[model samples]
Target: MLQSIQIMALPLQDLKARIDQELDENPALEVLEDRETISLDSMPEKNSEVESYFENSSDPGFSSSYDQAAADSKQSFMENALSKPESLREHLIWQLRLQPIPEEFFQIGELLIRNLDENGFHLEDPELLVSQDQHPAMKEMISIIQRFDPPGCCSADYIESLKIQASLVVDVPEAIYPLIEKHLQALDRGKYRDIARAEKIPEEEVLHCLEILKSLTPFPGREYSSAEPTYVIPDVAVTRENGEFRIMVNEEEIPVLGLNSFFDQVFQESGNNDQPGHAEAKSFVTSKIRDARWFINSIQQRHDTLKKVALAIVEYQRDFFIHGPKSIVPLTLKNVAEDIGVHEATVSRLTRGKYMQTDFGIFELKYFFTNAVTGTRKGGGSYGKEAVKAIMKEILEAEADRHLSDQKISDLLEKRGIKIARRTVAKYRKELDISSSYNR
Candidate 1:
């Protein structure tokens, strides 16, 4: 290949910096400051008439004083809420100290507990814990630890947990114990009649025993652990205005950047050749102005891209915005990219960690895309999986009188021209945390 001198396009990083500099010098572009929380319900009746929703109030006294108080309280609350909880190992050791056991046995239990998962299940077998000296009695010591509260805490498997629970039963129902020991799958599938016939007991008795089984805690360690709830901060806020959906970006959640005109004027006036330190003044002004401008443009670009992407999402998932999540149809990255005239990667980046607000609730920008269930009459009609789930939820909610089976749901979808298999309906239903017909 012949070597040749060639000029290629500027790197995105360099372009970004250049854009930032231009934005700094330009007065039209402004970076908004971090805004205070605004109550959507309390917004003025005519939002369009308001020049800028982002403009700050001129009430300086109330602004500074109230802001200080709010900041302090928020900091205190965050500190209190964010403290780390004790780990699973520490919890196990605490519990162990309260129990009476031989020193060597306690040591074994400690080792076993250390290897346990957060669910308190023994991940390794007790046989592996036995050293040459402890080999003989190690099995018995392991058995004793297995008998802890949350019956299955130290068990190797869920079957062992159920077995431990069964062992604790005072009056063993004739075949209930054995049936539980062997046919857990059959019970799970709601084959109570088969189990009852095999065990020679009434189906009601089998169900009652199953009820007892259901009461047992499969994971006892949950009480000792803390689970953090995710808080979704909406990027766009949708409101009902004149019986129509009006969308607005939640400006209160993000900071705004704007130029300080006083500083800019000072720099400009000081940078004249006649000034004592004109060069230094020019350099400093040039640098600061460049930085300020870049910051402002980056913020604006972020807002513009976010708004465009969100608006496109709104247009695509209009049914969902009007109705709810269930109305959300299966959509794809390509669709949005094509509609917005951007690359799939651009769409991905825009949607990353971004959320939207709608009449139904706040959701991530990516949540709108779902795979369609092909061959379903309605399913083929541009409906996404989210829409399918929405329809399923609607049907279930309306049918308060009785539970709708997966097959029944499939048939209903078929009637609506949505072709879906029974299993697919079951899978989506389960994903939604809606249990089977019997359980429901």
Candidate 2:
């Protein structure tokens, strides 16, 4: 049961892999092809008892529903068959092939490419490659490759990459290169005045150069990454139609499975035989048939449980879907578990790594579960932690000229009846990646 629930929690691509593994291991399990449909008539009837069993079984009804769903899902599957993206190494190699460099230089270039890390910076010392004889030509090749499409392909570090990229700009400020070379630490700490004092330039001029420096890419190679992108397929989709939220489970990717008719016929035939090996064959066939039935039933249970949990979550967080994350109320796994008449562990398993697509955006199912932060004032309503974070983010964004300290932000929230501590405000700011008031 836990394994089945875990399977339900998997995203589309992962679920497909799991299904492929099961099909390889279980002979009784088989995927129905596009042209094939499982029906009672498809199975061979060797006797009255076998025909009676087929008529009373639930397999025919399940197959009918599976066929209908499969027909409706064909177009969606085709639409989702996306093409693979090109990587950074392939792009660089193509450019190198087009160059008129010497054939021997190509080997050196390939070595240089191998030394470059994912961020487009050289991992090994370039001087290590050159002896006294090939020093000048090797240095020239390295320089040429550095000036490739990314503008900083073979740099040693971010400072070197920035310098190489800055040289490409026609009207780059003179102070920009010196600042990048000498005072990178100060620049990171937002110390513009220190840079101005050292360079004997005005503070405003230092600020201007800082703006230009910010425009350069620190990791140029990451822009054309070779890694294959992982796509997310939402398990549930919530859309609004005429002011009502409807929850639809994304079962289009799941394949319908059934027992092989050949195996079913063998099982029926072996049951009537009285030969020496007939008893053993009959036992084996019965076991396979039972395993196949259990596998199909488990899949159906997983489908039903996913739909039930999704509907309950949609009903519980209706206000959030309508008004956005700000309106989300405090919720927990226990609340959803009790609502859906399932255990807390079951709810947790269902939500793990599962995502839902809403009219607002695609969000993880666990995103809706937030702890309640009590208001300071008596008789006031409690606020969700996510709601408080959203409010804090809004306050920070609107502080245009004046920089608000954590204490000041806490006071502002208190005025709005939130009563969060200054430390809590600072922690939230860090989580949101907002710098301190001094840095701002």
Candidate 3:
């Protein structure tokens, strides 16, 4: 049961990998039907003769052109691969190779590049990286790396990175350094008056300098970020049809599995034979059959539980499906457990790593569950924390001359019968990855 629960938590991609491993290890288990819809990019050229293979889709009146052997070969040929992007270190090293530098300096440059973090800022002091004898070379490497393609890497921090880029680039405003060092915090908070008074400069001049610095990125290495977008196959799909919601567990994503007749016949024939030599063969066959049956059954149970949980979610979060993400109400695993006649642990495990596609977007099933917001409004009105966050997001995104404060947002929520504290609003704003009003 524990093992099955773990299997239930696997996403579509992980589940597919699991199935592939099982098929390779156990001859008794086989892909009885797997029909995939080929996209335009994957489709064969005109006048080409190729068999169509689909995974987890119903037959669309097409047949496989390949025999069993050919089918096995095709499955091996078509492997899924996740592409990786160029890393910050790679980008720096590539540029370093093109530079006309000594071997010692080149090695020091590679060492410096490796020490830099994702923001193109050094993880440690450049002087500390090498021995005292090589300190001078390390410093030279740091400067060289700072002047790399990004023009801001190998610095101590974003503050230093901005300064480094400004030095290398032509026509940098003289006021750019002071503004970034002293008045950046004030400028971020819209305190132009304080900045102008402190620097004895006009507000227009301050704004002009800030605009010039905008061309220089504080974190230059981010442009070559290796972080790739996570691709997911939604395990469930929620569709609205004729004023009703349809909750479907994506059973078509996994291939239909069945027992291999060859293995079955061998198992049966070996069992009938009384020869002692046949005992080992019969025992092996029996074990393989049992293993195959359990694997198939476990996969089916996973889908069944996923569908049941999805239906419960759709029924409870009907407002979310009908209206959109903001309409999602407060819900807990305990609530769904009781509704589905299962334990809270079962509900939690089933929902983990599972995604559901809706009209709004694909969201993890866990995304639908959020705690209720504190302090009910007048007449006992309540709000989900996520719903309140969505509303807060909408408010912040609306056209405005100035950024709204956390307190102002809190007041706005209160007006809509969603009573929440200013601190809570700020917390939610941060959770949504939105900068504070000061940095907006």
Candidate whose lDDT is highest:
3
Per-residue lDDT of candidate 2, residues 252-349 (tens digit): 77788898788788877775689897788788778877777777777777677778888887887788888887777788999988988989988887
lDDT of 3 by residue, 306-421 (tens): 88888899888889888887787889999999987888988888888889999999999899998987545556546677888888888888825568999999888887888888
**What Cα-based lDDT does every candidate model obtain?**
0.70, 0.81, 0.83
What is the descending TM-score order?
3, 2, 1
Relative to the true structure, candidate 2 reaches a TM of 0.75
* TM-score for all models, in order of appearance: 0.68, 0.75, 0.81
CA deviation > 4 Å runs, candidate 3: 37-87, 123-132, 169-187, 190-213, 374-380
| lDDT score for candidate 1 against the true structure | 0.70
Candidate 3 lDDT for residue 439:
67
Residue-level lDDT for 104 in candidate 2:
79
What would you estimate as the lDDT of candidate 2?
A: 0.81
Per model, state how many residue pairs clash.
Answer: 21, 1, 7
Flag the better candidate by TM-score, 1 or 3.
Answer: 3
Give the 10-residue window scoring lowest on summed lDDT in candidate 2: 59-68
